[model samples]
Target: MYWSVDEVDATPYFSKTMSRNRFQIIWKFLHYNDNANLDVNDKMYKVRPVLDYIVEKFKQMYQPDKNICIDEGMMLWRGRLSFRVYNPQKPVKYGIKSYILCDSATGYCFNMRPYFGEGSSLPDTMFSLLDRLSGHGYTLYMDNFYNSVALCERLLEAQTNVCGTLRKNRGEPQVIRDLVKTDLGIGDKVVRHNDKVMVVAWQDKRLVKMVTTCHQDGMQKVDVWQKGHKDKVAQFKPECVVAYKSHMNGVDKLDQNISYYPFIRRSLNWSKKFVAYLFQMCMFNAYILYRARNPGGCNTLLKFICSVVKSWTLKVHERKGSELGEQVEEEEGAGVEDGDLEDVKHTLRAPYNTDPESRLDGDLGRHKLCYLKPTSKKLRPTKRCRVCIRRGTRRETKMMCKVCCVPLHAGQCYIDYHTTVRYSVSVQG
Candidate 1:
């Protein structure tokens, strides 16, 4: 639609701001890590840097309320990937699956980890995601996928509370499991409890099983539209059920917010699509933080994103103008006669420093390692290694990063220069 010629489908703003070819070029080069430095054991190494950075930023920017929830989120990807999951229940049925921990009230994501495979146990994954919140008095709500009797007991030991729908086979009390088999009428419920856990089997339209470490066996009245009733009528529900219903939609809310104006697009590379999904998540998180700071601010997510885009686009235009002016001046200076420049002592400017993050982005441009050309009539060409010079050591190498134009030693030094934010080396004697 952005490139549509039809009057109804055309979005002039996208075309005016950036041409389709420019957008495609940017998309094609969008990357977060050097392919050469990827860890073979880690499936998400291609986008691990951005993924970890965003997750850490998400946690640091905000503290979630006591009432938080855990749920699965899906990033739509049709491309082939080893860990892609399929679930008809999710809005994006087939995609990469992620376990997300979110604030129940505001739907702010606290932490998220993409599912790798069967190698990671459920308990281990849960504990890893809740590492920061464990030992705090937070109440975590989840579905059957994560809630289990043993897990609830473990969380209670960690001083955290758990409440969610439970599967029959997930170590539920035998009494509760038997109760699930029993036939019951509307609003009928059976409850069983120990010192640390409570299990409930309630029959409304169907049998609902739940386990909780925080809620009681008490019932709460809620409005429900029955089969024969013209208007809604009051129905007795377990307190746990009511609480679960209220808080379990945190991940869902996050998904809904990003779904409206998603940054993700069709891509042959699943990692690219995943990175775009992460970017969308970061934008939503920023919106959440913005709203929190300025409660009275009326800027919606779309408006906030548009304002950001406008500011960035203006900066780009300014940068282009400055670069063009510099080029013109350089051309005029080159045309000056040698006698005219002889009176002026010109100091060579330092090399322009490129962003380190951009260096690691694995862009499509040629970035191969090649031998430096000899400046003098020497048999072998050698330049000071960029990594070694930074380490207070004077080491030279013939090999250099072709795109960066900076010499670096082969193997570890080359990988470190592209992969690490800070490359360290011990000075040799």
Candidate 2:
């Protein structure tokens, strides 16, 4: 719609701000890290700078509330990556995974860590995520994946509290485990406690087990609707269950807000897609801070994002428009003589010969062999092999070097053209 010419499909806001070609070119060449200085050990070295900077800024900008939550968020990717994860429960079933910590009240993300496969220890991951807020008396809520009885005790030692559903075998009290196996009716409850943490197994539709370091064992009355009853009825439930339900959606809320106006799109490169996800996170965090300072202001997330886009493109649009017009005028004014016209035509038809030293010095991977795509329905694209043409023999092929933009036959012709300084001599020999 950005570049559509039809009346109904055209979006003037997009067309006026930036041309589609320019946007694509920018996306194509976007880079964050220097290839020469990359750390071979780190899997995400390509985008580490931007990722680290964003994470630091997120923590520096805002302090989270007392009640906070941790959860896993997925960045949709199905490429051949070493650390990609699959979780059927997530809306994006296959993608790169990241652990995120967010404020329960405002849904602001404070920290995030990309999963580096089984090498990363769960306990260490939790401690790294909560490094800044460890001793601040804040409560952390999460799902069974991150909640273990040992982890809860560890957090309590750092003056932090944890409340979340626990896995059956995560060193919960044996008594609670036996209780879980027993058949119980709805709202039936069993509680066990040590000096530090409390384990509760409550029976709802099925058995639900949870561990908490900071919730009372007392029951609270809540209105719940049951089958065969039209009106809601009051039922006594565990206080920890209520608190867990209320506060365990911080990361989910953050994901929901980011999903509303996603900046990411389909891409072959996982690094680029991950970078776009980081940018979206930064935008969401900015929106949170914006709403915080201006509670009554006319700034919804959509409006804020639009304003940011407009501000970024306003100057670039005017400058690029003028530059394009000047270039067009120059092309129109210049005239080619009859003698030079053929040379111009040849230059347009064949690739200009590049410097041989630079072409042969680097890794062979730098030069890509690609099939010549057909430009028109009636014609198949072909070019005279540069090496064959030089050796007094004409050859045509549907294969070309992407970097050099010169056609060559696959075997000896392609190798000689890139490797030999005088490829014609090599062909003759």
Candidate 3:
């Protein structure tokens, strides 16, 4: 992630021209330590806690506005899984589907559900997701996939209002679904209401159908002023369209933010995409919280990500520098005329020998050792690089990520050794 701040591809960031220790250790830790427990049979078990943790954090950190929205997001993953969906309409034609619930005003995700495909119904999932944040008089803006007359009535009973575009065939009387163009024209609408729920259809290009329990059958008058003409034309629109236009795209906004250089490492694991999605949600939520307090601080998502990455990388360097200083101090104190102590130069075998957080322990998940160590060290040096020698700069270099047939500089020539993102170095070895 730090490298992504300055470099585009992973190869350029972790070049074979550099010592492979740092790159291999980081790569291994990033992939293997997810802080989750997973069973072989459960598809979502790997990322369930990740998503739950992010959502719970968002809920605790921010109080959403009165309006909320529900939408679907499909990530681009063609991995082997039982419930991988294929929706040609989505940006990713084949991947897992997530039903996202976000705050309409702030675009903060409150909850999400990954489709596991074993007897999971659409309405049931939507209701369960909304159940997390009900009773707040928060109005929901949803799409036809999760909307029906029956469901809206149920939500109304819980004091939550629902406004969404609905399918004509789902829970609608045959008389209403079979309306003709002669009965309704441009700027015309019809409504069917019971005690709590209402279904309205307004004519735009075609008939736009919406079901709601939170809104009234009100028409709003808007003035259409032609640019060249001075006359103000009066047009009428349904309250559903106006409200839908205002609040229904929160989930879309979240998806757009996540697609910006996401931290999804390429892996065969299907749950990697889900975990990456959760992490993306966490970052986006954090950005939202930041913006809520400082409105003008970070203008866009990309800018927020850049600032976060740079600050974190700087902190890591500062911490490492302190540790290095402490190590040097200890080495200097080794031969303090105590007569029992050995010489400092003999004890200081390596500059990097220090305490690291990467140690295996009883926690069992993230306990793997992550420190980097070289396998062999050549006692004697060889000739300088011929190019540098010709250039009168005699720079000597030697190291390799894999088994080496030729000596090469580990820094500048990193791009020369590994031309691809694939790494042959093993962190464990």
Name the candidate that leads on lDDT. 2
Q: Which ten residues in a row have the lowest lDDT in candidate 1?
A: 342-351
TM per candidate? 0.71, 0.71, 0.69
TM-score-best of 1 and 3? 1
Off by over 4 Å in 1: 1-20, 180-182, 228-230, 320-429
* Local distance difference test, each candidate: 0.79, 0.82, 0.67
Residue 110 in model 2: shift from native, Å? Answer: 0.5
Which scores better on lDDT, 2 or 3?
Answer: 2
Provide the lDDT at 99 for model 2: 95
Full ranking by TM-score: 1, 2, 3
Residue 323 local lDDT, model 2: 60
Q: What CA root-mean-square deviation does each model show from the true structure?
A: 15.6, 14.5, 13.5
Residue-level lDDT tens digits of model 1 in 1-429: 374343222486566457899998987888879987879889899999989999999999999989999899998877678888899998789989999999999889999999978587888888888978999899999999888999999989999999999987888877778764347877888888889998889997679999999887799999988789899998889999999999988998899999999888777988888888988888888889989998877478877887667776767667756664543333223323344332211211222333333457755244457665433355466768878888878999977665454568988778778776777654232
- Model 2 lDDT, full chain set: 0.82
What's model 1's TM-score? 0.71
lDDT of 1 at 39: 91
Global CA lDDT computed for model 1:
0.79
Worst 10 residues of 3 by lDDT: 366-375
Clashing pairs in 1: none
Better of 1 and 3 by lDDT: 1
